[model samples]
Target: MKITDDMIDYISELARLRLKDEEKESARNEMEKIINYMDTLNQLDTTGIEAMSHAFPMKNVFRKDEVRPSADRDDILLNAPDKKNGAFKVPKTFE
Candidate 1:
């Protein structure tokens, strides 16, 4: 696909980008190169190749979810700047 000046203008408008007269040509050339590279890649044969989400295998690194003791509610409420009825009080956010 060829990148034209009109296409660049449309893309710039959609992206809310302000491309100068001098920069339009440069942007067009760069976009053309990217599209050409994608086209070249599409021409490659990938029969029997399995689809992968990443180049390397992925594993969960998070710790196991185990039940643990927590601090007292009175101890946590002591840190609050404003507390009423054992709960933190804040200004109303919505009318």
Candidate 2:
């Protein structure tokens, strides 16, 4: 696809970019090159190849969950410098 100056102007406006006269020409050239590369890729034959989100295979690595006893609240709070009503007291994060 041909990248025109009008196309560049429309794209810059949508992107909230302020391109100078010289920069507009540079952008047009770079955008044309990118489009040409994508067009070239469209010519490749891969009828049976499966599409993938990533280049490598992916799988969850989590271990099996198991029930376990938890630490006592009193024993866990022994190291806290300040606490309130059986809970750690921290500085207010929001007004």
Candidate 3:
């Protein structure tokens, strides 16, 4: 999975990147290191380990939903910069 200079060039072209020779070399080395690390991880043994979505045990901790009294309409509308007939108003932009 080592990234070659040609591969780096192709990726740069696809991404529309303009890279100097030094940058291309740097990218190639970094990509190679990432592939090597993945190769190292693949060598680990986990024969009976169960796959899990979460690292720790978890349960829903949400509070029960309940309807509550709301503020008066006029009080809430007071914060609006522009209002019309108890509704927020905005400038019309198009026909």
Candidate 4:
């Protein structure tokens, strides 16, 4: 698709960008190049290839969950500036 001045203006407005007269042409060229690259990529044949979210496989780094003894409640509460009913009391976020 051809990138026009109207498209550039609309995109800049949507993105909250204030492009100068010279910058508009630069932005339009960059956008056109990106669209052309995407079109080139779409021409590739991938009949049986499975779509993947990542280029390489990802593994969870989290340790296994295990039940364990915790510190004494009174001891933990002793350091609190303001706590009530065995829980940390914080200021109201909203009225």
Candidate 5:
């Protein structure tokens, strides 16, 4: 389906976008081309092809979780702009 100027205007309004005339024209043509491509894809026959989550082979690539010694509290708190009781002290917003 070809995207019309009216469709572009409606889409822009719906999306709260302020597209220029040139931008609107460009978007309209791109959208029409995408719709045409989808229409073409609809003509393809995929009776036996199984739908897979990924296009390529994939495997779990996770590292084993392990406990490690962390830096001392003093070392971490040294960089704080305003710290109190080994924690950052920001100004309270509420009364």
Candidate 6:
């Protein structure tokens, strides 16, 4: 697709960018080159290639989740500077 001055102006407005006359021309030329390169890529053949989410193979590396005994609640509450109703009390953050 060809990048026109009007298209550049529209994009600049959407991006909330204020470009000088020279910068607008430069952006238009850069956008045209990018689109031309994309068009060239569209000519490639990939009939039997499998689509991948990433360029490299990936695998989950998580440890097994196992149930374990937890520390006593009273033992934990003993260390708190402030406690209320068996829970740690914190200052109100919002109204």
- Give all candidates' CA lDDT scores: 0.93, 0.93, 0.88, 0.91, 0.90, 0.92
The number of residue pairs in model 3 that clash at the backbone is 0
lDDT of 3 at 10: 88
Error of 1 at 60 (Å): 3.2
**Strongest candidate by TM-score:** 2
Q: How does residue 27 of candidate 4 score in lDDT?
A: 87
By summed lDDT, the worst window of 10 consecutive residues in model 3 runs over 35-44
Residue-level lDDT of model 6, residues 6-89, one tens digit each, is 999898899999899999989999999988888986788989989999888898789879988899999999989999999999
Better of 3 and 5 by lDDT: 5
Candidate 1, residue 95: how far the Cα is off, in Å: 16
- Give a tens-digit lDDT track for model 1, residues 1-95: 99999999999999999999989999999999998888987788999999999889999689879998899889999989999998999999899
Cα misplacement distance, residue 44 of candidate 4 (Å):
2.0
Misplaced by over 4 Å in model 3 are 44-95
Model 4 agreement with the true structure over 1-95: per-residue lDDT tens digits: 78999999998899999899999999899999899878887688989999899888998789779988999999999999999999899999899
* Candidate 2 C-alpha lDDT tens digits along 1-87: 899999999999999998999999999999999988889877899899989987888886897699887999999999999999999
The residue ranges of model 4 lying beyond 4 angstroms of the native Cα positions read 46-51, 54-95
**Regions of candidate 6 where Cα sits further than 4 Å from its true position:** 45-95
Query: Residue 82, candidate 1: how far off, in angstroms?
Result: 28
- Model 2, residue 63: distance off in Å is 14
Ranking of candidates on lDDT, top first: 2, 1, 6, 4, 5, 3
Q: Give the winner by TM-score: 3 or 6.
A: 6
TM-score per model over all chains: 0.46, 0.47, 0.40, 0.46, 0.44, 0.45
List pairs with backbone clashes in candidate 4. none
lDDT score, candidate 6: 0.92
Using TM-score as the measure, name the better of candidate 2 and candidate 3.
2
TM-score for candidate 3, residues paired by index: 0.40
